[model samples]
Target: MLAVIQSSIREYPLKPQHLLPLALATVLIGCAPSPDEELNATLPQLSLKELLPQAVANEYCNPKLDSDLLYGIGYQLYNDDKPEQARSCLIMAAPTHDRALCYLASIAEQDSSKDSAERDRQAFGYMAYSAVKNDSCAEFGMFQNFTYGMRGQTPDIDLGLRWLERSARHGDADAQQTLVRLHSNKGNLPLAYSWAKVLDDQAQIDALKQRMNPQQLSEGEQGFEQLSKIVTSKDAVRKEAREENIAVYSANIHMEYPETFKGLSVAERHALMEQAVATVSARPEFSTRGQFYAYVIIAQQAQLKQTGVDVLQNPQIVELLSDTELEVSEAVKKADVILGQAAL
Candidate 1:
């Protein structure tokens, strides 16, 4: 009945004499059959799928579908254990989608069965490159590669530091947290405290306190105070410090000083020890971006412990070790010895 009416409405002849009655009838009939009546109609009778395009065309202009919607659908498909279909959707969707590009990069770099570690590394490099082209968020993965030497990367500390700084300045909390760790490890307590202050959550602060000792936190606060004073002062030295020392002071310890603790001065060694302690404490507190915390801290501390004892006959470091604390693996011990001798 509605289709017939609609068809008559479309085909209704109009002449000068009938114009007024036609207009009146059209107004009384309204645009389509009643919506409620349509709801009571059977699926087989309505054939909604066939009519949907025409219905939409009648109601509005071309649809304003967003790239994000497609990406979301693609992500849903991916999470539904449909990788190939998800990949196809994402491929079609990514041309205008930055998040899709980032996801593609992650997927390419993450699919272990698709490639060897070396191949993945190369693939990640390309993805990182693509990500950077899109926006600042892409730097996150690039920094990851620098932190861990992959595919003969040889650990480019400078690149890692630069990328982290770039990402942090762009309001990335993960990058900010990383900078805090990096600065804290480098004994740049001022920077670490500054980063920590940005978190602005009481629970988070308490959790951080649980990870780091009061003494360390106090020292960091003092460092921040001192730095604040320096920046506030009009002194030439302050300018010089900002211009020159900030880079050295804020640099990541692990990347900048990758060497095992062999030739470090007593002061440097003590500072590093404090950093190691803080690092160990902070590791378990963060689970989201802190995935590698325990591994990195353990490896670094073990290396430092082994080399410090092997090189300077420093009973302090040796005394710091317990029988069960040191790794007794022959290869590790041999590497420690080599690092110790290299320092001398």
Candidate 2:
């Protein structure tokens, strides 16, 4: 055990005159909450009334201006028609919101007096940050700015398309619609059909079908073939299955000896799963992860017991399942073929 001497500098005696200032300094050094750098330095030194109107300061620091609460207050201010104040509040809460940076970029766009190039650069920086943080809306914002050059940057079609693709993958219907239009107008039917099929924009897809010859349609189907790999991955399937509260199975390693594995003849199931995994191992991307492939094969096997095998759509994928996109897709296709033949 240790005893500590609580002493101030000996030169500064314990005078009443010094007590208040020391207490104030303690508050400044310790209790004050300022997530913003500028405000952080000065707010602690100022009286509560001087820092903010007494009520506002009290509420801003109510429980404490924690990250979540600061975001809430800033979000509320934005909804209350106080966008300018909201910007200040949200800036202090930067990089965390229901996509606040995009909102800030929009607000910044209205400052017509700022130099156009500089203003666009500022907005672009905010949007780019938000996009990489996986804000679907910000990704879409980045897509537009890049595609059209509206933010003073030159049009970057390839980069814009990549952003747009990510935004669509994140389930922004608007981004999907843009992809549909872009691919359709460019006569890239296969890519367009992929987008259309995802969104179930059947009427337009049907119209496009009428114009395609068999080769064009076949080529179109193949063009977007690689895209579905994400959903078919073991991780995606497990997440979707868990969210739906579906039954999932354990692999041999996951359980010492699960009843399910025993019920299906452990040796046979393991052999079939390995065989299916071997088919995908032919692909380089998935060849390296042995155990991961086994987990995916187990997912494919689970689906086979019910109906068809689609590792991505398997409601019975194991909880701890993970696999590469290449492995998962190949596993599903190969497993379906293997299991389908076994059932027959």
Q: How many backbone clashes does candidate 1 have?
A: 0
- What does candidate 2's lDDT look like per residue over 211-257, in tens digits? 88888778656544544432133355344333212111222222222
Please, what is the whole-model Cα lDDT of each candidate in the order they appear? 0.43, 0.51
Which structure among the candidates has the greatest lDDT? 2
Q: Which candidate tops TM-score?
A: 2
What digit string (tens of lDDT, one per residue) describes model 1 on residues 9-97? 12112122222223224334674543212312311232213211221211111123234334545565555665555555555555555
Poorest 10 consecutive residues by lDDT, candidate 1: 1-10
The collision pairs in model 1 are none
